[model samples]
Target chain A: MSLPKVRVPYLLLFPGFAFLFTFFILPIVNLAQTSTQTPIAGGDTGEYEQTFAFSNYIQAFVDNKEQFARSFVFATFSTLLALLIAYPLAYAIAFKSGKFKNILLVLVVAPFFTSFLLRTIAWKQILGEEGFVVPGLRSLHIISQQTTLTSTSFAVVAGMTYNFLPFMTLPLYASLERIDPRTIEAAGDLYANGITAFRRVTMPLSLPGVVAGTLLTFIPAAGDYVNAAILGSPTSKMVGNVIESRYFKIVDYPTAAALSFTLMATILVLVTLYIRKVGTEELV
Target chain B: MATERSLSPEARSILNSQISRRGVLAGAGGLGAAGLLAACGGSSSSGGEDTKTVRWGNWPLYLDFDSDTKKYPTLEKFMTETGLTAKYFEDYNDNDEFFGKVQAQLKLGEDIGYDVVTPTDWMAARWIRLGYTQKFDAANVPNKVNILDSLASPSYDPKRESSLTWQGIMAGFGWNTQKNPKGIRTLDDLFAPQNKGKIVVLTEMRDTLGIILLAQGVDITKVTENQFMNAVDFMAKKISDGWIRGVKGNEYAQDLTSGDATAVIGWSGDMFILASENEGKFDFAIPESGGTISGDNLMIPSTASADGKKNGEALINYYYDPMVAAEVAAYVNYVCPVKGAQAAMEKIAPELVNSEYIFPSDKTSSRLHIFRSLTPDEETKWAEAFQKAQGN
Candidate 1:
């Protein structure tokens, strides 16, 4: 005898779906609603009324273009730097390490064991004017007495690179490990040298990982405010810092929400275009 | 019905159980939604008369702690005498940050879980203006007579109904004596060539801008937007020219102690605390032009129940006693806001009774100016301008 079909999968998803609907989707809807609100006449510190104020986006953009540009620039630099540093390290672990591979991988990810804020704060001490690095550099005459490393753009970019390095390394290591030794050997047998074999065979095969690593590093670096807040000066403020101050210190939720939406939309458009250009057919 | 008839009895029963499970799941989901709605509509008061505990939120290091007992002496004494439990929290960090955390609940007239909180003058003004605070019951606090006349009627609460002065602090220049032996005497001294990139300024807009306005020959208490922006412009130039090392809040103390900054626009209380630790290595000076004097004030939030308010008032009254206030003042090292506390301090800690930072002399008091209260528009505009000047 045949039994009637039951929709168990849909039933299993109902609880989780309801949770996301209530928490995630509802907040997004509320944020979107708040983005179009304006302060009421003579309202108290944080009071606002819905006015369909679409110009808030334009106003936020105009007011904070410098911060937006700085964020993107910092993110781009950090992504490229992370890739440069991580690719070789990941490649070594994938191909060169014999018995110490596990330990090295653990070392690569060990920074995560500490809190992100604490690690960033440690960087502050290391890069401060009174810190050993600065004093040593000054004694060597590499930097002037008046110059500092703690509150500069370089400090901010270095912080972003350091914080996001593991994100780039893990993905590259995964892709690189999947590369067959036979392919490289075949290229070598076909008269290609070591560099040519890596360029043609290994590198091209690792494009998927490259795309994933860069996206992972770049997206978070763009939205990071902590490093900038702790290690960088006001001149190095990023869009995330502006958004943070707007929300917490200024209590201007409408402008902050509008700015957040604009940032999200911009990042989405850029990422989509990037993925499309990179072509993800060979990602697996 | 046709499909069910084709199924075997066992399979049909299994299917029936599955349907029942789905029904139970839907019922649970509906129940959860209703529970959430009920929670949202629940009473917002912190506690009723049955609660013998009062929650007090304050800034870090603002209380007198007895290291030997590992407890706040005055607070422990109060609890013992009154048979009340005091849940003390040092969670009141930055004014704006704490306000942001509680503003929504406060706006809804809901408890933020604190019966008493100490906010600075400007923030207390905003709380009073928004009706977010409850008036003190004078009958509950008979020690209100000990409140110093100077702090009795602040412009924010002219009748002293909603807030009582917690502690007064001065915003002035703090210098590392080893690094800058000459020390800072004026705001212009901060801009000197040798001091470039070695000077840290406060992130508090009022303190920083007030001093700059004072240096520019403008009164901080009657500042116009034009005057304020002019002062801001001066700061903007200093920051862009690299004359200023960084803009910081409470962390400026770390910079000074670590020698990352030789001079800083810092708080008097912090400098006093730091100097005691480092001996003659550091010194604080009221800038020759003047310095900003601000105070943290205690108030009961609107969401506090009548019982909680009574308990909070009793706590305030306990602390307002001259002997208890002196103990707190001697430990905290801030300007005492209770009359007779200085005299009471001589018996408790004679060494601290003569400290200028704790009890300013008339000449020093004359050099301290209070930042004017801002209108709503001015607050927004000035904050935006200051944030812009700070390059955020």
Candidate 2:
């Protein structure tokens, strides 16, 4: 039998393809081209000439390796912490909350209603030396007077986890809410306790959400500069801050673009490996 | 809408499957495109008509506003006299940030959407050096004669061909009176063991490093790379030792008020405002080694048409009138660059007539030093060192 030809489907793809080509693909191509440029000789502050200086990538990596390492380290910690916090909260909202589920979900996302920068600044205040957190801890002799919380790695990580928690929770909640209660009940009847049932049944089923949530949290967290800027000290500065300063302050676009491409490539490779390890069958 | 709700399940499923993904993706794409458009927006119109509307970009709280009238009185008066509408924008938050925003357009000789912009001295010098600014018609600004003699000839524009001073501020050490009862008299005092983790420095490279260089007995006016590197090393040591709390911009004032910072390297005008609000809670002191003085300057970008330039000059000329200058000085609490504004303040706001910070005493003036303009190469090197020390 001959298949029916359809012109509508191909036409339907045009808008999406055009949009991505103009906004995404074009910019990435431009950024890739910019990554190889070099500063013009005796030029003004921001002047540059395209020289195909692939060495920019090496120079950027060498100069900012510590920042790059710190970025991934912080992102990994924050992602793990967010998962640990989000899973339980998502589970409760999915199974425990009766009519208040929608409200709980809104509560999970209420922090986003405020500006991200403003929220980060609020965190700075809360963790400041003179703020309630430090003084209270000092009063209880839990921390020394000079041991501040504001400009530290811990604060930066905590801020990232807090800011990105919703990204982890919403996905987990969607997958968890769709779970069949009968399967878990059957597992219970088949000589399984609550923990065993969850591990054997629910956890494996929620792999898609876990994978999706972790990727969402990790990618943006790795590129986050505001949290580190507001809460972290120079010692805790991340790669994102370096890129920002290079582009805006130093006006060194080539190094900034090179670092950006490196970051994107690193994330792409890591994500591919992660998906493969997680198994493609669960993603659908 | 009612008919659409009555669709069959199979048909609705097919429709939803096909349209939902594209709909969501299209929505997101539209949002992204809107943001990109907004980011690149500026005046695209060329000047042929009488550009009666002048756009002025300035820092926040730099002009007096009548609470009762809910309008900038001086600006209103200027507009009525010139028959021109002035659109004032308080978007000049930081000099470098503003420069980064407009530099691309300025380089291409395109309008940055502002007829007048107020950038700090170093940035203005850079603009003049790059030929990105238009010269003011001296004939259009007769009130320019009232400009302070000391400010009439900056090294960057000795003839005052391109820029005019808006406000000058002293960069010095300020401390909370309640927090530091003994007082912070010098850079050494700020770095003393007792003040550890309570000190905050400015993020502006010139203000922070210039003060440090001055403290080290190096003249900031013509600092050498060795002197700059030494200052950077000293700053890095303080940062690594946790002696300095953080590097901040305008937020240093908030840090001071909240007691997060006991002492800060801050602008004199900000210190005055903070002190006045807190009532003896804060005090500003110029270090014995002298403090760095810098000014925000008004200049027309090269993109401005001849008509726009004239209107900008008219606005500048109006503000340069000693009475109008005094009005701005009384509200802004910065050093007025117009020479006769001090005497004019005697009638306008008598209380501020002798305010030393706004109109520096001869002794105070003698102790203030200007950080000399750096060559492009030196600027890049110094900025890189500063950024590294800043942990970027």
Candidate 3:
């Protein structure tokens, strides 16, 4: 509808906009301001000096570059690997399989019904030094004696992938399922083999799902302090863990707020650039 | 609304200098784009005005309520004497998380509606630094003489005159009999090859590292920057080497129960939970090298209403009554700041009365040391070095 005709709908949207305005937008602005406000060092009637310095950003990046780089690398690698494992399983149900497709879909989304913390913790218990997986592996002689999975990067990544597999697979399945099977059959009719048919008709069309699923799996995993806090060691701590330490462990509100806003701004820039290069609309 | 309206244009503008409405609206917009956060909760619970309330934020499972009874004796007597009602809260899960939530109201520079707030040692220091807490007059708390001469005048509060301590306890060593029949006797026991993968320590920056710092024979309380660096370096090395089991909450007890971890740096109050669960299987002890002794104190917020502060200041003194302290001691199993409360508890519940964990003998007292404040640069370097050492 034209703007003149749709004034009522716009009016209807005011409540939601007002709610978001009061709760969301106000906090970020306040966060940026609070981050810069320096508490009085020496006296009463002394107010915090409002200085807009960018050192908080420097601390998040240059000062703590190692953890920042590790977080980015983890996000990228986990997303790519999730896409690889997810694509084949989704393809089987969408392209070749006839029966049990809906049943398989239910199974994919089922784990989410339980507590995410519980599931992540279950993985920790299973992967601990004397836990289910390590003991079972030892009994079968699949690994050497005395090797434990607890407090390792492998355990962290494995837990991440397992927790987020449904996110990756469901989107890929939806994208693959929406494709016309006859297009592949049409390629075969023109004398293309199975590989050629899939490469030409299916792969190009499914890129959107691959991108979406990768994002759905990866972005949340980047901010996952819980996984590191429970399943991994200090070596496995992420940027989220650092943010938490500043916010809670130390009462450096200015530094904590500075780190929070800096992380947020960095994520925005990275996402904006990615969208620009990859065509944001296609990510759907 | 009252204060804002009372402000003249100049005063309002001054308040707005820090954060204007536009700034708040902009932040709300950004948060909307993020997602809805849970609403800010008020101070604990209150049954309402018919009862004068004291809003408390204490650790979970610390307060005692009988299975069939929710009786709190000190609270009852306080109500009887003062004709004021009691509304105790167990809302504080961790000290830092509570600070994060309360910071907003503090910034708004208004009544947080809490009559009393409690936090641990260094945290009390942070409140004093931030000016978020109120100052008290020593004259009001004449009953302060009831506090042990030894417990008075902590490093955090030089006169022991400002903040009222919630409970003071030693953050020492605890062991499981299931793993070490002979016990992990000293700080060196933590780094032993045999104990490599089977140890659990606390995540509190001061307690964990300070214990290790003391074990190295460095005085954690009186340390230079270089000495402090050595302590962090040592801790970071052990953490990165995977010699430590996990840093966590009170679940160190759970880790011991499941045999995932054998011994840990633990609080004495938590020993009550573990001893109940595993019976004589576990015990808490101070190592020979001496671990950090810490305490929690109740602080008055700067914004406490004048009327409330007047009464609350007196109420703080009132709790120091020997009978009141003894009843509180039975309910809360930490060090009785009140001098003679232990003997009173002995007359009440002889089992808990004799428990040495609640009242450490004088020998343990001589070795105990309270934590010292970190300089800003030192704090920065310490947090960074620790983080780097924990890196993959």
TM-score of each: 0.91, 0.91, 0.82
Instruction: Indicate the worst ten consecutive residues by lDDT in candidate 2 chain B.
Output: B3-12
Per-residue C-alpha lDDT of model 2 across residues B143-226, encoded as one tens digit per residue: 888888878999989988888899998888888877677666689878877668878899889999989999999998888899
Give me the runs in candidate 1 sitting further than 4 Å from their true place. Answer: A1-5, B1-50
Per DockQ, what order, best first?
A: 2, 1, 3
Compared with the true structure, what per-residue lDDT tens digits does model 1 show for residues A1-284?
Answer: 54445767777799999999999999999999999999989887678999999999999999999999999999999999999999999999999998989999999999999999989988988888778998999999999877788778999999999999999999999999999999999999999999999899999988888999999999999889998988788789998988888887777889889988998898999899999999989775
What is residue A208's positional error in candidate 3, in angstroms?
1.5
lDDT for A132 in candidate 2 is 92
Tell me the tens digit of each residue's lDDT in model 2 across A1-284: 64456867767899999999999999999999899999888898888889999999999999999999999999999999999999999999999999999999999999989999988889988888668988999999999977878778999999999999999999999999989999999999999999999999999988888988999899999999999988888789999999988887777889999999999888888889988888878773
Which residue window of length 10 is worst by lDDT in model 1 chain A? A1-10
Scored by Cα lDDT, where does model 1 land?
0.83
Q: How do all the candidates rank in terms of TM-score, highest first?
A: 2, 1, 3
Predict model 2's lDDT versus the native: 0.83
Model 3 collision count: 22
Individual DockQ of the candidates? Answer: 0.40, 0.43, 0.31
Of 2 and 3, the candidate ahead on DockQ is 2
> Worst ten-residue run, lDDT, model 2 chain A?
A1-10
Model 1 over residues B133-251: C-alpha lDDT tens digits? 99988899888888777777788999889898899988888888776677677876666666677788898999999888887888888889999999889888988988777888988
Fnat of each candidate: 0.52, 0.56, 0.29
Instruction: Record all residue pairs in model 1 with backbone atoms less than 3 Å apart, i.e. clashing.
Output: none
**On TM-score, who's better, 2 or 3?**
2
